[model samples]
Target: MMTFAVYLIVFSSVGFGSMNINSHYFNKHMEKLLVSRTFGLAGIRNIEDFWIFAEGPMLDSLFPEPGEMDGNIIVGGPRLRQAKVQNNSCEVHSHLKYLQDSCYGHYTISTEDREAFGPGTTSPWVFSHTGSDYYRGLVATYGGGGYHLELPSNKIDALQAIQALRQNNWLTRGTRAVFVDVVVYSVNVDQLLIAKLLVEFPPTGDALPSWFFEVSRTSLFSKSKDYYIFVCAMISMTFNVYFLLLEACRLVYLKLTYFSRFWNYFDLSVSIGSIISLRFGIKNYLFIASTLDKLPDGVDIPSFEILARNGFNVKVTTSIALSLCWLKIFYFLRVGSSTLAKIRVSVWSCVLNSLGFFMVFVLLVFAFTHLAHHVLGPHLHEYSTLGATTTSLLRALLWDFDLEELQRSRPVFGPMILLVYLSLVLTVLWSIPLAIFARSHTDVMSEISRRCNLWDQWKEMVWGQYSYRQGKVTSEEELRLLLEQEGLTDEDMAAVLSRMGVRRGQHVDSHHLRNALGCLQDAEMLPEVAVRWLTDLKQRVDAAGQKMVALTDKVHMTLEVASGDGS
Candidate 1:
């Protein structure tokens, strides 16, 4: 129990630390860079907007100067790549003077080697005006049209390439879309971040089109792997090993029946998933580092996508394993608590009883979904598709639908259909499952109560037998004090103790007192008629004792007063 508690605490701490680092440091900075009005995708209206965005917030935020000499802040300059289909007929025209004059061909420009293009360069591959290096090769079209440019990390050189593209009217030509991919690696913080912005131009008008931006980040130390992480990992491994061995022993002893219990299955899954998740988490950290190392001069920019996908897998697996681990708490709780056991039983019973009703409910929902789609598909966008209609119907079931919109869509059928659906679902269908659950819960509570009462009765029977066989003893003085507190006079205490053969300073046996009292009652030694008489006698004796004590106190006070007068 202690080990499981420590594991949960450590796991929660690690999860919290990871969330803090990702949300506070990485996500906050990325949001500022991507959502800024001045430089964000939303503000790009003309070709000049691209220049302002690239040179302004993008540079300042993404390509910030290194704080230390050894700081590893590697930046992959944003590349505006336009994908185009390759043409076999363009093979011969590829050597044309102008790339635009020739048929579209696959090629990428290198901004580093300016010497590839000399003065008066007319090669279709080279951008002579910009002095940029051009390499003729196959480029991924990605089902798009236009030329692609790979800009250098140098801000001025990149700007020059952007200017070259602008001067050549590349953006205004047959360009359907331009993709900007940027990668930044902050090794000091072990963070690899990637941002992609897509700019799509309008099909007819010259007006600027909309842009979509996305950012994904993965970190190695987001969970902060300190000494405690190692310690917890070791503890977790030890526990898994111990449980596996214990389960194996149980399986051997109990044979196949051991697997019949649901908790055993839960234990095995949690153990296996935990080990696998831990292994993957470690590999994910190394994979991020390796991917970051290749991003500096790496020709394949899509590697960042692979890194992000792997990081996401690690997170998902870890989450599942952690969730299973936490759920095991319920299994443990039900063992010591009858109420929890009853709750578990009730839930199981409810599920079993409601299975048929659940299927019917699902069928009804789908029927209504189809009806809504057929009726309101043309009039309302919410019911335009089967999936959308289903979602809207479910929302309506939860009282979240726009009643006014529904009424406006089809005045005659809309309100009528909605009324029928709600009436049937809420008034009839919903109540069936509730009634089943309530019945199951009541049955479980009554059954558990009956078992608890039986167990209590058995315990009491055994305790009664044991106490009769071995009677308890109490000191005579203690017994006398107890009787006095119970309003019994001193004479009555002495008589009872003497009748039981217990003298002063001696012990009184409960068996002897019981036997003597039984005998006295049977012989009518202390009669029922004398019970009120004895009670009245005891009350009178107590009153007399109080009066005598008061008189003694008065006598002492009078003596003191007389002494004072004499003096």
Candidate 2:
């Protein structure tokens, strides 16, 4: 029974571990997808120019504009609107070849522009007016020249312009920043074509801050393995619930009997906690995925990243819960056959014996902790506090001492103190306690073995083919064959039969077997022990039977005399 339970727990843990690995990879894939959508679209394209233009009011429309920032502004582009045509604006291209040549090696915002704009000037054409450092920095770096400076008619035109830039190598997939300059006219706003020009540049090794707004792709769910995650979570939770039910049934049936064991509570706690943790973990991921599904592309949902991070945390918790659930495998080794039972007993005996050693070791550790804190605290940083001293000593106990720290302390004195400490801790205290525990473990096992031998002998006699008026009768040839199979010689069989006093062709019963076993236990020193015991048992039985017959006769005579007197 115990073996079966152990196999079940092991199989469940393996399944859970596989699911955890899959979920981890799934999270990584999702993160990569997010990064591709957010950063890949605006990467630097042209090596020489290091500038890519973004057309129209791209991501600005996804968020509500700040009231303090001007509504219509072009941050880093030409101020004229198609040379101000009479009825409609005509496309006019401006040449900045002279300016580009001068700023080839020194691509920077014009000093006059910087002074006039003053970091973040609120104008219809100012990029920093929106108060976004990402766009503002891009405008300051690459918005000087080699820009399209066009107004897009719609969002599609804006997407096409970005895609064309990427294809033309003017906008690489690795660019980190995109600058947009929008010019909104209060009058003739519809004819103005609410559009902005974006300039992208390569990142300077510094990663974008977390608060930076990011664009998301439309097919968020398609890139993730949420289906597999959900399935695994469901399967794992179902198994945990099954275990919970089993524990409940055991509690109901065994009542106090089940509660008496410590492992029962451990299993119950793991089962309940795993169920709860897995449920909440699944809920968190699903909620985040659903929320992301409802959001439009290029929309900056601030909570999306936060929710993703929270989901990852829950995933870690679920993994930990799975790990804790594996502790139940130990509970299954306590029952079943005598061999397993003996193992359980011996292991528990070792644990109980080790407690004494642990108690003594803890006291010694505290003493050393105080000594280290006082003596070595001034010289070594590790020993500066009582907690630190205790921690250092604990690590030292495991042979993980920091040699550098010891060497850095008062050179000779530190080595001498450490040597003495190691001598007391490793050589004497550690070895002695472990040795004591080992001795106790051996002694307990030896005693258990001795008792188990007697148990085996009794069981063989009472249950095997040797009991009197019970169990199967074995012929002499059959018995000889069995002994031969056990590696016993013919002489050994003959001696055993002689000790039991069983003649040729006579059936041997439980009495003969019991006597033979008793003689064996005493090294064949008292072969007649079982004979004497059987004779005594027979005499007692015969006496009791005679007493019973007499009692019956007396009862009948009393009844007949009473009837005659009545007549």
Candidate 3:
């Protein structure tokens, strides 16, 4: 338990530090982007909308005019790139189909292509900036590719760069999506903040598709000289390794029986997961930091999308492992406390017994889901698909349904259908599991009580036999001598004897003395040291009694020899 506490402390410290640094960077960049007018680029479906956003307001208010900014502003501030499908011949039946089909073949334009186009070039891929000229060039070559547009620090150069991309067939049917990466470096803290904006084109949408934006941050000196983090890492690794070995030894000792216990699985999983989470978390942090440091100049800046994804993976894995670690605390508590142990048994039994009832409940929900989907799918958006219908029905079971909306969709049937679902699921299906758990809990409590009574009876019987044997070996004199040696005065002995229900001068055995000592201890009349002295004195008195008997027998034999010699 001490080891577990130390490990958790170290792990939490490292996790908190990393989270603080990353969240600071993320929020700083996200706040700026959220307040920017150009952040609504996700709604850009046409060239007119794109131009309105690009030229209307600056990307970041802090650096409204890139040319006016101090040298502190990083050179790799903001850039744009687009991904296009290479093979446009695939027959896309729906929006989902288009997404999946496009995934099979898409490519972003390389850094070399952008560099070759040179500054002020109208078209990067072709001689002319026209759509026909670009199409002709694509057909002559590999048929399709993406474009990289570099927006220099100066406002004029940046606007010119935007014009170059806008003149081409960039937002055509072949285009999959456009990405805008904005990187800002804070000289005060030496931290790099990044924001990635993704704008995807839908196959069949009159309104523009909603855009996605992700923000992340990393520190420059974090990886280099944080000795505290290094120490935490070493300590965490050591504990994880120790736990893994301990679990492995237990598995070997228990063999297949080890899997029968649920907490054993938790033990093994948390150990392995902690190790992997830590390893990858550190590796990804360093990798992202290094990538940010080596970012190329011009339009050739590398995508931070993959690096951002790696960081997200680290967060998710670490969260799961840490949650499991905390949950394992309950396992230890359950083992140490009888009340918790009984609760665990009752809950587990209830789950096993309610499996059949759960199956029926699921079937009922499934049937209602299909019924709602078929009936209201055409008119109501909520029940448009099977998945959506299931969600709506489940929500309705929890009284989250809108009766007005349902009635508006289908005035007569909608309310009736919901009433039936709620009545059956809430009144019938849910009640069975509750009853099962209640019954299991009662049975567990009764069984524990019966076991407790039986245990008490067994203890009483064993102690009775022990007292009988002790009475045969010890007597009143021996008890009195031992009590005196234990520092009991004559008055104390008389009072103790009175408490034991012994009359004046009555015989008292070792069993009676034992009972007296127990009463004194319970009443706080006897200290632990006195009890130990009494125990030692009792043993010494018994040994002395045996020696006296042997000596009396020898004297009697000597007296018989002397009598025979006189005769």
Candidate 4:
């Protein structure tokens, strides 16, 4: 049950389900924000012109049933509530007021929308300065005829013109003043709704702001609901604390020798990593939150924002520690079942004992991989680099088996060469390691069986010595002799006696036998083997005791018969 609980904790620590929930919640609104920000048709001097430029043929696809252009903005909101628009001849002033009153319709401009006249150009005969010949022709034609017109071109050319107009700020006053409105949004349904302070750019210019941009709520520390994040942090800290306490108790009571194990040091390191990760995470979050509170509109805080979004140093360290923690679950297999224990022991023994075979396998792979690269490098791009060649060969060995690529690269000899390479890899690299593992498995199993059998025999010897001693003390020599008589040789009896710390010629009693059994049981010796061996040993001891008793009785009866004859 304790092992099961540990497994459950390890699985739960991944927290992938919660992460998925967070992603789904944010993705819905993020898509809307991306659409509104990237393709939002606001602040364009000519909606039709910008649409033609941005979307090309896709313009019709976007607005199939064109009723009116989308200009979703409110002028007299929080930021513009205190501003007054100065009189200006620019058509944009009229457009702003039009939006405030009607709040609908597309924006358009007349042909005489010139900011300056060339020195040589006549009145109503506008001259082009920093514009294309196309623009100059349009200006001359419009100035001569006094007719309002929109440019006609394909999507590609129109988009280029629109880009030029935006860079020049053709719609603003004098192209000198800039205005911006920053709206902080919290997600509502599938769209962003304004939740906090509205900030306008050019704090000293005309109190009216030009356009707006949306930012996520997490940018503002006060608005971000990071309570769930904090809760997760607390859970991680609690888990680490539990780990430290357990490790400390083991070190204190299970002997200081417990700390010598690699796993104990590993657990300590992960616990330390968890603590440091949480510490830095909280510190960085609070720092970002404070920075967000001080940020002004139209100002960027890229570093802090990215840190909050992706968790900076905290994510790396926490992930490292968490991955290590999950791997620790395999340690429990050492105690779970006999098969599990055998598997763990077998794998380690196989890998360590077969290092020479593994080295040879690597040598073969490297050698043939370079040979293939030399032959196929010019034809096959995957063989262009040594790393790429190694990867391709390794993949083929694993049965990814894309020999067709080689055939395509080299039409005549590729198939034959590939067959030879595959044979070498299959026979030398794959078969050799597999055979080593199989042999090592048999050897390890035999060793485990031999150890268990010795444990059973040792327990039987201890029981036999205690019974034959007849509740009195007996030397180790007597016990060794008795066990030797029972088929255990001097060497075998000495090995068992040494394990039990029974010095030669040292006295042993029943108490010693009971203590030896306790130790063997604690060491996880097979219980059924010990029980069966002890049952048979007790029967043998009884038979020996009865024979001794019968011999003594016969000697007494003979003495009595001799005394009666003398009388």
Candidate 5:
């Protein structure tokens, strides 16, 4: 059993890493760059003439000189790689870039990096050393406890991916600045860092400023197989839903459940499992992250074999997800000897439809990821993590994001991204009123249906009672009496009168009474004739009012004469 579980884990992780995640080395390199750039939780900016990245550095000496600051500070695009050593020192490889930096304010360099700096720590610290060589600065912080021997460039790549996904952690700096664990990115002139800060860090038990959330952390280097498998499971579920819907529609159209039977239980097991994987299985094994990298075109290179190894968490999640898909595809599809086979034909087209729907989930994920990266800007991973990547994908679908200040911390087009998202929000908001109207209509219809049944039943009991003169009182008298006995309001009494078009002393034509009673809750439950009986009785009451009044007057006159004779 353990072996089987292990196999599943391995299968899932490997698949997710190789297939779902970008397999190319080039993409990984780009991710390295993206993650680092975004690490400036303080927020960075790119100028037309130059890209200005700002972060709180432990050693200020790492920045480039004034002369080198002009023009493009980075000579070439970043050279991305994993770190060789842990606890890499901090170096601001200025090559002369900080000359005209007007972006940052004076802030204390929180000295907690030593305690928090390391690989896979729950809370990571951005560490540094005052050195000119980017490589030297990198080595001081890479490790299992680190800035693990991963390059800062990799973080940049992660950030780039985040940006590509179109949402971000960017927000404006308010009266209280966002707490950013701005680590110095120490990389060679070739744009490669010897070490990178770990996403998770030790908080060092220090109480950070108000914007502590800005301080990003690293996550475990989990296998991607589970994520991929989970994704496939979701695709399968989406397809299953489509198939069932199609089969149901067909069944309704063709007047048979034969075509729809197969899909009847599609959502019953596989879908439930898929849902489970989506919520927990995938979550346990994989992480979502925000990155600053743009989508790389080619990813063919194999850079790090060790990093490619699947982790346990990655394996199990993937296996379970794939298992869900397999059950739907193979088990359910092949189980024809069972009685449920009768509906196979009806469900076949729907199965095809569901598979097609899976494509939609895939396309949507890609499309939104692309849009997010492009509009949100490239990720600068100075504070990126693997978990955030998955989250960004979800955000694109949900369209709920907040990054206004990060965009505004600097004067740039970054803040404008909110406008696009806000426009979408407005469109959704405008539709809400219509949605509410529809909901109200359904509720009203349902309520009336429930109550109408009771009305219908009551009407049958009273059908001939009034017409036969079996009841001594008229409907109006009954109405008044019912009010006293049945706890009715003046409103209820008024509605009955209004329906008949009858005033207290006046009689209305009985034609409209049936229509009014038909609108009641119990009408459907009663026989059709009962409604007519009430209608006919109302008319008799209106016509007989004068006769009843004369009788009352005669009785009163007799009583007065008797009283006089007795006196």
Candidate 6:
């Protein structure tokens, strides 16, 4: 018994400690990861015409370490160079603009490719950029993920151009491999950082306030899709704690009855598995693109595409985790906490309030598609466009949206009406506390009454047994103690027993009048009434034994006759 008690204590301690560690670890990892995960791919005017901005993960390695961030605005100047058909081949006339001004970041390409614009003169220098473009992905705006193989043998360029103009504008004309360029500012909002911010630039040519991104600590974790998987794993564990720890586990503790603990173990196993799976996912990605002497060519496509796919998987898992959260809220509504009842009862009210958020997502899609339909004659475009607006819509849901706009577009009834309705609906929340208080009060009162009734019967039994180890108890006190132990209080028990004709000095056979108590061990898989009846029979064996005797009509006469015959 001592060993079992010790084991239970140890189990609880370890479980809680593990939960803390996992939560802290996941939080810190997510915080750092969020900073590194954002990379922006923007169209830069005329320096190879485009730039890619990678914020967090993309820069963890590529981004130069601290102090390396200098006070220079322009990092490097890359311009195209013209070369003849000779194989001295490629060179970018890169001038080191190495002073970091307000902020700093490192910029480098795998190998810069600068080519001569025309065969005659090196005067027209042309610079070109390429990046993790090897793996095949569709320019979806042109159509789903199909790459038109540009081979000299099949020269139908005109038809291809026409086909592209007929679909989504997610791409551009003559796009070669995509190049990723990054600019990382020491974005901390300290003295030096904000001083850099005072540089006056006008979006409306000095007509408006400049838009700036402030480094506020909204969450320690990144809003990146990459972190979604781990977030989901943590959410799953939270659900397990709610259902397994708070509810089912408590039920087992109550009534002191033993049953299966399979659900507890199952939830723990899933938590562990999710942690392992994420680690393995990260490893498989970077290691797959290995460069060796035996290998003839470099890896196909950039690594980010695969990383993006992993992010999508995490999103799916996150959705599952959110669903679990709602499930737990519902579970607690039923059996454990009293507060969740009203909220659970009127979730449709909460859902009604959320229609605005839902509409935000839906309307954006409709607006974008309607514009697309207008331009390309119903979802067509010019210049094999790939990513214009639809992708932006999906991204907006995950990354916050502009709430100010939502505020302006108040529905016809006004936001107040809906707000009031939501509050009114949530009024059901009153039920939870009501139920809990009622249950607790009722249980206490009933226990007191029961113990009081049993008080007298218990004293009689104790008195009968008292002579054997006797102590003075006027029948009343002994009966009171027994009734109290059965959950009846002194006053209530006195009143009830008085009504039952059990007075202070009464002495009667308790066995004849005692109502069988229900067994705590819920054994049978049948109706509770049936099980209670069976338990009563098991306890009254002595009464059953007396029942074997029978009264005969001529029993005494028969005995007299028998006596005479013997004489």
How high is the lDDT of residue 540 in model 5? Answer: 82
**Order of candidates by TM-score, top first?**
3, 1, 4, 2, 6, 5
Q: TM-score winner among the candidates?
A: 3
Q: List ranges where model 5 is wrong by over 4 Å.
A: 1-263, 266-268, 271-412, 426-567
Q: lDDT winner between 1 and 4, please give it.
A: 1
Report the number of clashing residue pairs per model.
0, 19, 0, 0, 136, 48
Q: Poorest 10 consecutive residues of model 2 by lDDT?
A: 80-89
lDDT of every model, 2 decimals: 0.60, 0.49, 0.62, 0.50, 0.37, 0.33
lDDT digits (tens) for residues 247-324 of candidate 5? 567657867555455444553444344444444434433422222121143211111111122222334454665665
Residue-level lDDT of model 6, residues 289-309, one tens digit each, is 331121244222223233334
Better of 2 and 6 by lDDT: 2
Cα lDDT tens digits, model 3, 60-163, are 44255557453235445465655444444345567677456642223333211222233444434432211111111111221123465556776667767667
Question: Each model's TM-score, in the order given?
Answer: 0.56, 0.44, 0.65, 0.47, 0.24, 0.30
Q: Candidate 4, which ten residues in sequence have the lowest lDDT sum? A: 130-139
Report RMSD for candidate 4. Answer: 20.7
Off by more than 4 A, model 6: 1-304, 307-407, 430-567
Candidate 4 regions off by >4 Å? 1-14, 21-229, 238-260, 276-296, 299-305, 308-319, 372-381, 412-418, 466-567
Model 4, residue 475: C-alpha shift (Å): 19
lDDT over C-alpha atoms for residue 99 of model 3: 54
Q: After TM-score superposition, what is the CA distance of residue 348 in candidate 3 from its true location, in Å?
A: 1.6
Could you say which candidate leads in lDDT? 3
What TM-score would candidate 6 get against the native? 0.30
